[model samples]
Target: MTAVETPELDAALAAAEARCARQGATLTPLRRQVLRLVLEAGQPVGAYTLLERLKERRGPAAPPTVYRALDFLLEQGLIHRLERLNAFLPCIGPEEEPCGHGCGHDHPHQFLICTRCGATAEIADHDVAHALTAAADRLGFRPSRATVEVEGICARCA
Candidate 1:
């Protein structure tokens, strides 16, 4: 199950809301609901799943509506889109990243994905970032995006 009732979750929401306010962005009720679902999911959640859940309460909502909310959440650094699963997960990190894209997508981070339970964690470390950059340098590559996902079992699942 997703982290249903935790202090960290509460803090995340509060921080997100505050950040949105600071930037003159609206974390609308609908967007907030979507963020909650993704966070409580305890794993990556697909757009379809989010749409399904929204329909249960709101009735006959369109995919674009959810996507728009998702995009807003992503821009505010409240959630992230998992590249591998094409799913969304909460941004559980402590600080904000530069917003060249006005979204956390520019943030260099790594994901530890639990293949067994589907639980995911986010990590932002300098060493790992350097290693990625160094490897890319070997090929004279300029990295644009740097979100990484590794599939394995988390300690809880293991």
Candidate 2:
């Protein structure tokens, strides 16, 4: 498995630290480990999954220990939470800012979820989101989030 924490990992970490600095937040050691685990997994992972992994390396890690870090990462947009799967995956690239409501978090994205190997990839189309949101406004419909998860087998699995 190609670990996501490869050479690109350094750039991601730097971007995250800069973003936190702007937001007056600190990337604690525990939070950094959580982010590393998610990225290294190269797939969506649940909090318990991370907790178990952490325990193997750092001894007994409580649920709260992992949860707190997950929460912080989510708030910073260093990671994305898949509502349907109740799991999290790292964003495609380094994020310079948090993805809050209206901060482009609603950017239309088709999350490709691979069932066989449990991998996930987010395909975002900013133009599509703009067009869809505009059309909705004309029809008097308000849309908040534009992310959609499409499930299927990945090429590797096939």
Specify the highest-TM-score model's number.
1
Quote each prediction's TM-score. Answer: 0.81, 0.78
Candidate 2 residue pairs in clash (backbone atoms < 3 Å): none
If candidate 1 were superposed on the true structure by all CA atoms, what would the RMSD be?
3.9
Q: Could you give candidate 2's per-residue lDDT for residues 66-124 as a string of tens digits?
A: 98998888776677888878998875354334332224243456688888887777777
Candidate 2 Cα RMSD after full superposition onto the native fold (Å): 3.7
Distance (Å) between predicted and true CA of 150, model 2? 0.7
Q: Which residue ranges in model 1 land beyond 4 Å of their true spot?
A: 4-10, 92-107
Task: Point to the candidate with the largest lDDT.
Answer: 1
lDDT of each: 0.77, 0.74
Question: 1-158, model 1: which lDDT tens digit per residue?
Answer: 36645665666666677778988998789988888778778778999999999898789999999999999888777777899989988774323322223345555778898888787777776688889999999999998767888999999978
The residue-level lDDT of candidate 2 at 57 comes to 81
